[model samples]
Target: MVEFAALTYGLLASVILSAAQRNSKMARPHPPLLLYLGYLLCGLSAGAALGLGYIILTRFIGH
Candidate 1:
């Protein structure tokens, strides 16, 4: 379950980041490597945070 949630959130984050980049007014000819790394880091962090939260919630609810 945790793996599933993390994978889902990570993919979601990537999709959203890509969409935002596409819609930005100041579109760059090519995105910087740092920017791509930042997106990956953001998605990983978001997924980790959510997974932790889910674990805590399940424990709290005695599931």
Candidate 2:
């Protein structure tokens, strides 16, 4: 479940980041490839944290 959540969040983050890049009107310089990778990594981390939190909450709540 954690792996699936991570992948889903990573894909969503990448898509949103790429779309933001495309839609921005500022004269910003092109970002490096690593920047996109970092974005995906951040999303995965977020998903992991969320999944863990859910697990902890469920355990305490007797779900």
Highest-scoring model, lDDT: 1
* Cα-lDDT of candidate 1: 0.75
Against the correct fold, how does model 2 do in TM-score? Answer: 0.47
Q: Per-residue lDDT of 1-63 in model 2, one digit per residue for the tens?
A: 979976887787777677567646565654666468657777767987999999999899975
TM-score of 1: 0.47
Clashes of each: 0, 0
Predicted candidate 1 versus true structure: per-residue lDDT over 4-50, tens digit per residue: 98798777777666866775756755457646866777877898799
Which residue runs of candidate 1 sit more than 4 Å off their true CA positions?
1-31
Q: TM-scores for all candidates?
A: 0.47, 0.47
lDDT comparing candidate 2 with the true structure: 0.74
